[model samples]
Target chain A: MIDWLISGDRPRSVALGAVLLGILFSLAFAPFLFPGVRALDTAATILIFIVLVASYDLLLGYSGIVSFAHTMFFGLGAYGVALASIHMGPGWDALIVGALAGALSATVLAYAIGLFSLRVRAIFFAMITLAVASAVAVLVSQLFQLTGGEDGLTYRIPRALTPANRVGELFGVRINGRILAYYLLFFSCTALFLLLLRIVNSPFGRVLQSIRENDFRSEAIGYRVVAYRTAATCLSAAMAALAGSLYAIWLRYVGPDTTLSFEIMIDVLLMVVIGGMGTMYGAVIGATIFVLAQNYLQNLMGAASDATSALPLIPDLINPDRWLLWLGVLFVLSVYFFPTGIVGRLRAGR
Target chain B: MTQTLLETTDLTVRFGGHVAVDHVTCAFRAGELTAIVGPNGAGKTTYFNLISGQIGASAGSVRLLGQDITRMGVARRCAMGLGRAFQLTNLFPALSVLENVRLVIQARRGKGFNLFSIAASHVEMTTAALAVLERVKLGALRDQKVSELSHGNQRKLEVAMLIALDPQVYMFDEPTAGMSVDEAPVVLDLIAELKHDSDRTILLVEHKMDVIAKLADRIIVLHNGALVADGPPAEVIASDVVQKVYMGREIADV
Candidate 1:
């Protein structure tokens, strides 16, 4: 059954499988088990990012493409949902239309970028994506009336998805629309992740892997490298846009800072690298750990700093204000120790 | 004329002021094994690159069975039945040996785009890929990564990939350059086997005289970016141009 889900590409490491299962179970029961607002938000965010990070993995890890314009696609999806809700009013149709429009636009933009710049060297493509992403960021900030500008757009979704719509009780936990929204994100992300798994295990995915290994030889072997790259780019962009739509629906808001930020792009890159490049499961582990650490690590640091306030230098060094510093340290240590990312390390150890 | 499999008309490539391949016109007919020989820095590989669409021709054209493919991309040319192996082994080093060959077969068959189909579920394709691997004597190591294979085995794997591609025109650049004597015969034997088909054309670029003498039906010698001699192996080997240039005696033409 597991083989069917992943199309027979095993996780290959017992520890890795356990971690993935743990994440799956926790996500599946987060609303019931965690029973708090912040925890639910974090869980929902992780679910959304699982799709976002995994889609990025398909591009960077599977196809050897380094694209910085991922946030542009994500923002497009958010804005798509935002604009649809504002113009068309709160409903499922608006959400669907907005998501589709965002995905379509993102795919088209990716194809255009891929066709124009993929012919150049990898570094040049990276530069082009960076430039394009920056331009989109600038545009989103300047397009005030249309996009709500820097402040971003906040609007309604279906009433059933909001915290106000109580849907009774389940196992001592009050069931509400927010819980429904969380489950919606959960199931959609799982299905999407499985689809990505199927793709990476398919013949099409192997061609991308081969291209990543040696593109010059892939061309000689009759696989059009650029065409496959463009196709993967388009697919990845659409997936990311879908993830963004989910995020906007959950947050009930879309802003440049929330969706189109460079930090989010960096986070996606970090998650992919920390998870392992080619292994899709790495995305799950990576996003879970990175998001958890980002949210909770500072709290732990703050407590530690308070405890060590009696000591002069220690409190200042490990201060909660420097959570980013600690995060950087963690990233460096992971890269140094794991080298191939956590999943790669575990698989190698196995 | 035995259905010319590939032809080049004044095909040339230049890097700034340097002409890497200069106005090289040639043709390969069916059922013939043609060897391209040259002194160091002669444009033998460059000419192969031009023919295989690795590098575009600065001037002139390349045609496969009378269809002009000069502007075609590498994959397009391969799809149109042009198969080439590199002088240095080029392969998916991180993939298993079987997977490397299977991808070629998948691409050639145009089924590499099946997003939902499990690659292993294609039992017939796997069998076919394994058969090609067996022919190249890599069947035993099918599960091993290409990077783990010895240089000679990688070269054999390169041939296996080409065979799987099933192109009418086969371009091999120094196929046995790094193989041991025992390993060399396997590749030579496979080339000999490929030559058995009357519809196939083989082009080899090598510096070894004995291998050229043994396998090549005809020999073409290049002297510093230009085709200097073309004839049967015995005739070209005995010619003054090959004797002075290829044998490395001082020659002014280069």
Candidate 2:
């Protein structure tokens, strides 16, 4: 059914095909592509990062709000979900509740900032968000009792949201493992992606683009300029929270590092900008690139370790802690050659 | 004889000690077509801005239908039965011509927050928008994207958008500035029709003497941010000050 829907090239068919393909591809490849804690951890990092970037792009790319505090919303989601889960214990319902909590908390925070700063466009809005994120990070770190401080919190969870009672029985076949978890996350990501796609194509989406093109004209037409900005801000934040909540659930752990880390924020930004800021599929492309690059690059370094330890080119010369430096260089290069990112370049070609 | 629908009192706008608009006072009455004529830098556009609330009045007040609206924002002022067609074409270019007009109708109805519904599917709004487009003879171009429309059509679209809101008072700043000779009469016809509507008031800033002489029932002449003459167009245009303002100090030689 999904394949038939995807194979058709009409507008509706194209949309459905893209969505089904996304879901199928993610579910089919997640296990083999990302195995064990190390691989799963890296893949998870890329997934959450992509979600964050997509959330940012929804506002910055479409609505023209350059927000730097996107990580703050991600943190809010992570912290909100983790805290909610800690008090309630892990369950299918608990995960849903946690996601909702994360979204609500991020929305509230975004609302406060948006109410005051939506009037300030471009660099000013970006600065305000950065300040807010830094402040939240500081507050989280100082509150060791509730947050478990820098070390973070750990949890044990049932194998599944419903806790598969018959571990190896799914359609009379085996379906018990981390593969199930991967498929669960893959579905979640795809659902959010489709919802975003619907929003950007709608009338409301056109208005947002109009706002981006020229705000004064939008106001002249009686659209409340600030109101649109606020709504977009909250919606973007909520999407980031959804991603964060998934991360907490998948890992069964949450902490300040997950929420407040500068590294996490940059990673998300990289995915969106490198993949294509405004294009809907840019986040997925970005995540795939980021994950593949990190995996292969690390493996290449490991392979060369025996031969190059005496005259190490990267790890010895530059602190491994600064692996982000290389990512920064890549970002700069992408900005120079493909300012619109991959999706943007493809759009320009078309 | 018609009641004043919009008025500005001693409207002074200053930019860093230089007065852009200096103590200009005017009133626009329902059923009246008024032309404000001045050469470039005569504060005509500044006065329009002050009335439209695009920029805050440095020291003055604006009254709309006898209510003080000095502090109101542009959107609120628009919602309060005031509409403006800009000197420059200000429009949503990516939207279809019909959608552009529908925006103003939607604004007047104040249903902008129906997030779940498709905007293009709003039947009543689309009908109203198309009606205005038809009035401007832009109905044929309704489905075309605004960016695809020609400059004159875009200007007509701007006017149609303003008309769709059904404002009690319409402010048009140089409405025919970029129009061809053929296009100018269509705008003149629309303005004349608007003036004849009995309940509609029109205020315009124009340099075109032909339009001013043809359409203006009352003409207010300004020179260097001050009123030089205010009366019927024949009387005001006949004034030596008005003749000199138009002829640039060489009317006697001409």
Candidate 3:
């Protein structure tokens, strides 16, 4: 089964694995197998990031175009739903409309960016996107009325998704709105992940890979390089917007820091790089590992620091509040040991 | 009776006071294999680049089948049947040998925009790719990564990709550049075969005199970014100016 899953040129096995992983993650939130609210929440966050980073990989890994504007699209999606819910009143219908609105806006934004900046050199394109994204981040933070300013926006989700609605018991666990919300996230993320997998394995994807390898050759072979890159940017941004919408729904809040911040963009970059740049499976694995480590590793370090406080030198290095220092060490070690990222190493092992 | 397939009228490219391809006006006639020969920095490659639309001309126009394509982008020019092979062996290095050919085939077939269909499962593309690979005699190495192939085989693969494109005009820039003497003939033979199709046109830049003598019906020699020699191969070889600027005393002695 492992061979069947990992040994193919096509992405079907990887797509299947992603779907299965999504289902398992959703199941972890169930009461009987419950790992607690914090763990379940972390798992849900990981699933959402899987979608973000995988969509990101479509550009970074598949097309070899790096832009810092992904979180802008993501934030657009979150804000789309948040604003819609506040104005139109919270319900499933409004949420869907908001998600669609976000996706459309992101697609349009990406198309415009692609038109203006894609013709420049890659490094220049990156800088252009960075400048544009920073401006948008500042705009979102300063829009006191519409965006709720620096404090961010809080709005209602669908009644069915809120904790007040109990959907009945399942497997000795009382299934409620929160569980429904988890499953909702699971199914949507899985579907989006699968769709992206199919796209990257398609003829279009082949051309994107060709462009990445040799843009001049791809152009010489009759591929409109700029057009294809634009299409990829739009597709990646739209998917990211969808992930962002899900994030807004799950949290019942949309804040600049949580959605459009540069830190989130950096996190996605880290996920793709540590996961493996070119492999889609790398995104899934990378997000899971990174999110889990971010959530649990700090607490684990805190406990260790307390335990080792009497040990003098060890206490300083294992500082509880500075747990990210250890994670930084782990990240450096992983990059050194598995230079190609985890999925890259796994694929190489195969 | 052969018609002009491509013509560049006073095509000029200048880089900050340095003339790379200086006002080269040449025509590639259908059903002929024309060789552009010169010493290093003779602007043969730059001339090819100007015609292939890889770079814009500072001044001049390229007429392809009577259409002005000077300002056209590389992909559009290629779609209009202008194919090129790079001197540096540009290829999808990580892709399989088959995939490199298949992408060209796919591009020509107009399936490059198809996002929903699986590339590997496209039987038509695979069949076309395989046929081109077989023609180039690299069919046995189809599944191998291009990086794993020998430099000679990679050069052949580049030709195969162009063949799959089925361009009306082919621009070859040192297709045999890095090949051994023994391996050079294999590519020369493949290029020779293209001349049998009377409607196809070939523009080649080569340094090896033997290969030029064997294949090029006509030779256009460039010296300091200017065309100094243009005629049949034997006449061009015997031209005093060609010997002075490009051929040098060595080929004259021979």
Candidate 4:
């Protein structure tokens, strides 16, 4: 059965199987999962993280380019949706408009930065993106009146998914609660993931790989290196924006703290690196680890704090404040033990 | 009459104050084997770089089949029918030999944007790419990863890539630079076959005297970034300037 699942030539089949499994698992344990929040919230976090990480991998692992500003696109998408909800009606229009605005803004930034930085390779290109992101972060923080500065903004949204919806009925399930949101998020990820599979296997994707391997030889073959890289960057940004928009709707809030945080960047980086750079499913693995670990650590810490004087051992065992420190150690260990990342090591063994 | 495929008139490539390739004019005509010979610092490789559009020419113009291509990019020039094999082996090390050839095949087919089509779906291009590999006797190694191949095999793969493009003009920089005595003839034979049988317009920069003597229909000698001699092998090799350039002294015995 395991072999049957991964045996297909089409990457879509694998993605389909993975999505179906995730949906099934969530539905089976829906009652026990996040009682106050819907199953959809869980799905949303996974979907958003997966999309962000995969997009980051496409650029970093496949194209050999890094952008610190990638999270800026995610932030913009969330902000756009929040601002739209505050000003426009909730339904689907605000979501669409917000995503478009984020995409357009990211594409514009990608084109301008791509024009200059694409000529240089490796560290220089990485630094250029870091510089751009830092500058943008400063700019966002300075827009105090419009952006609500450090405090961030919150926007109201109508419920779009519940366990009793029509989508849930297809699976003999009800989406009247959070379970419906999980289905929506799962379906979106599956669809976008299928599209991503197509894009990665395409001729354009080969050119991107060729650029990664040898830019001069690819140029010799008549490919405009900059044009293609910029296209990938824009596509990656746009997909990330979609994910971000969904995130905003799921949380019903938006803030510069979410958009401009280095934590988001670290998560995306970790997803691509530890999960296995260049592989599409790396994002999913990375996101699962991150979200699950955060939830577990926070619960452990909360339990310890509640116990106060008696639970010194438990506090020491699950320190929430030291998560980043642990994460850094994990990254170093991953690099040392599996230099090619997880998937790369598996492929090499084969 | 056959046409000229590549013509460089007074081409000079200057880096700062130094002339790497100075005022070199040469025409590479179809069905002719042209050899460029020079010492280590003689700028022969630089001349190839200028013609291949790898570097900008500070003076003069390069024409491809009568179209002025002085400002054309390397990839554009390649599409216009210029193929170049580098002095160093530059095959895609991570890919299989066949995959590397398939990449060029896809480029030639201009199907670089087709996402839905599987790689195996490119039957005709794959067949042609395979045929080119077969021609270079690299067909047996097609399934092997390029990095796994020996240095000589890698060079053969590079030549195979050049051939797979079916370019109008083939530029080889030191085709046998790292080849052993036994491996040198394979390259010489390929060059001879390209000239005598396939009628390819060939421009090569080689240090191997025996290979040059065997294959060069016409030889042009370079010294200090300038062309010193251009003629048939015997006349160019016997010239006072050529002899002095190669031996660092006049040929007193001759």
Better of 3 and 4 by TM-score: 3
Tens digits of per-residue lDDT, candidate 3, A258-336, equal 9999999999999999988888878888898899899988788878988998887887787777878788988889888
Candidate 1 stretches greater than 4 Å from native: A305-317, B248-254
> Over 4 Å off in model 3, which ranges?
A1-32, A303-316, B247-250
At residue A189, give the lDDT of candidate 2.
69
For candidate 4, give the lDDT of residue A332: 86
Better of 1 and 3 by TM-score: 1
A95-156: candidate 4 lDDT, tens digit per residue: 77877787777777777888778777767777887898888777777886766677777776
DockQ (C-alpha based) per candidate is: 0.83, 0.34, 0.68, 0.53
**Candidate ordering by lDDT (highest first):** 1, 3, 2, 4
TM-score for each predicted model, relative to the true structure: 0.96, 0.84, 0.94, 0.88
For all the candidates, what are their Cα RMSDs to the real structure?
A: 2.5, 4.7, 2.8, 4.1
Write the residue-wise lDDT of candidate 2 on B1-254 in tens digits. 56999888888889998898888888888899899888889988888888888889998799999999999888788888888889998887776888788767877787665554556556787788888889989999888998999888888888887788788889898887787778777777988888878887899888777778788899998788888889998788778897888785422222
The positional error of residue B199 in candidate 1, measured at the CA in angstroms, is 0.4
TM-score of chain A for each candidate? 0.97, 0.83, 0.92, 0.81
Where is the poorest 10-residue window by lDDT in model 4 chain B? B245-254
In the range A86-109, model 2's lDDT, one tens digit per residue, is 778766666677789889989999
